[model samples]
Target: MGRVAGKKVFITGGAQGLGACFGHMLADEGAKVALTDINGEGAKKTAAAINEKHPGAAIAIAHDVTKKDQWESALGEAAEAMGGISVLINNAGIGTAGSIETESYENWRLTHEIDVDSIFIGTQLAMPYLKDNQPGSIINISSVAGLIADGMMLSYNSAKAAVWMMSKSIALHCARSGYDIRCNSVHPVFTRTPIVDPLIALGGGGEEGEKKLVRQIPLKRLGEPEDVGYCILYLASDESRFVTASEFKIDGGITAQ
Candidate 1:
């Protein structure tokens, strides 16, 4: 029942989707969690729900990951609330698809700001606390778009690919510095999350739409949130102590073909 017992985790973008799912899963497995989001009230509500099941195991913090001041303050508050930070999940991001020919520079910049730069800032600010809590884990959520290419997903593809490479660099740095902080990136395919609602809408919004989305996936289905959550659980726990600087693909064998 206690997979991450005594671990303190700080997760960004925990208002909903995978972030909230991860919070619930980790807390259920005995980790105290700090859930942060730009939607402050949403984060609080998620925290309250988790606390309902496991009282005092969850806290909510208002945070804007792109801002240095907010990152510093949020990490400090999370550390104080949870006693220390053993896991950091850089999960806040957006997926706006646009080709370079059609995408505005502003949109590209915003994409990189949230999807790529936030990881750099969050990891840097949280490194000290992670170092303090030896055997820490840093989980960065990338996307299959990062590993592959889509003409329409120009900015998202670029940003998430940056995250993929950055994670490896961070993992190597920690290893070189003798910090037992394992950093890894997770690449998920078209999961049944709100993030895919737009793509679903493009296909006319129904089972048929989902079928179209899964056509390329060898499994012929969308990924469940639990699919990625279980992987994160392993990385967050001591079971994956030797795993670092690697990419975990939650895609349905899309990369294989």
Candidate 2:
């Protein structure tokens, strides 16, 4: 049997990038997947592709993770579509690069709302369904920037750091309340995603710049979406029943060095 057989997973920002990768991977493992994104058309397109591959296994909804009402609506829809939500992946976020002094208050607010507040909304909205499931997982996507300092990504770093702490807090609350839900965050270094394409373009995309970045890693390679997807799968599955309140670093020794 697959790791997530018969499981129901709800993922935010699932139309593209790592979120899309997660949806595909989970559906392949026999899970019923519900994906939501701000782009309703993109979500529909992704759902179509997933359904074509997995056949009646996935659904998509439009959701703005920062909005509590949207979270509630999305959760209700997901539960209705997939039986119940056993896993929630808070994957919607944006990146900003600028020194603290140079970063505007508007940028900071946007970063925090998308990266940090989304986690709060997703986790809180999923709580009712998760409570009923008795052994659910809430995985928040943090970043290596969250764990370590990076130049010119002040707002991004701050928001991700908050996500890391929020995961821990929710895990503690669940444990104390005797809820069977588990919460954890995954911190990954530069993974190739649509969000990073612009940065790569600016740096001269190809082996030249790729080699430069890879050299910083002991593994000598950047992470793939599936690399993080598999890590999330393990955490979402029963194999990790005893694990909670942890940070899984998929940074290829970036943080270790």
Candidate 3:
């Protein structure tokens, strides 16, 4: 049997990249998948592709993670489409890399809204459904930058660190309240996503940046979307039943040394 058989999963920013990869992976494990993204067209395309491979397995919703109303609507749509959400993956986030002095207030606010506030909104919105289900899982996608500071990612790193702490807080709250839900965060470094492409361009196409980055990592390669997806699935599934209030680092040893 598939690991996530009969589970219902709701993912934000699921139109492409790591979120899309998670949707595909969970659906493959027999979970009913609902993908939500700000780019409605991209969400549709991703859902269609997944459905083609696993017919009738997924649905797509247009959602902006920063808005509470949109999150409510997305959750309602997901419940209607997939029955009930057993897994909530708050994978929607954005990054801005620049010296602290060079970053605008607007950029900082936007980064926090998407990267940190999204987690708060998603978790708060999902609580009712998750509590009703009991024994559900919530996974927040953080970043290695959350654990270790980078040269010019001040806002991004700050937001991610908040996300990491938020995950711990939620987990402790759930445990203390005797709710059967678990919360965790994943910290990954320089994954191959469009989010990092612009940053790489700032240093010349990621080649030089990647080489410099690899020197700090034993794995010596950028992480794939699937790598994060699998880690998310593990936490979402029963395999990680005892794991909560913890940060799982998928940084290829970047944080190890």
Highest lDDT scorer:
1
1-257, model 1: which lDDT tens digit per residue? 69999999999999998999999999999999999999999999999999999999999999998999999999999999999999999999999989979999999999999999999988998999999998899999999999999999999999999999999999999999999999999999998878999999898888888888999999989998889999999999999999999999999999998
For residue 116, model 1's alpha carbon misses the true position, in angstroms, by: 0.5
* Best of the candidates, TM-score: 1
* Candidate 2 wrongly placed segments (more than 4 Å): none
Candidate 3 has a TM-score of 0.96
- Give Cα-based local distance difference scores for all models: 0.95, 0.89, 0.89
Ranking by TM-score: 1, 2, 3
Would you list the clashing residue pairs of candidate 2?
98-152
**Residue-level lDDT tens digits of model 2 in 51-142:** 99889888999999999999989999989988899999999999888897799999999999999987877787789999987689999999
Give the lowest summed-lDDT range of ten residues in model 1: 203-212
Off by over 4 Å in 1: none
Q: Candidate 2's error at 187, in angstroms?
A: 0.6
In order of appearance, the predictions have TM-scores of: 0.98, 0.97, 0.96
**What digit string (tens of lDDT, one per residue) describes model 3 on residues 15-88?**
99899999999988888899999998999999999999999999999999999999999999999888888889
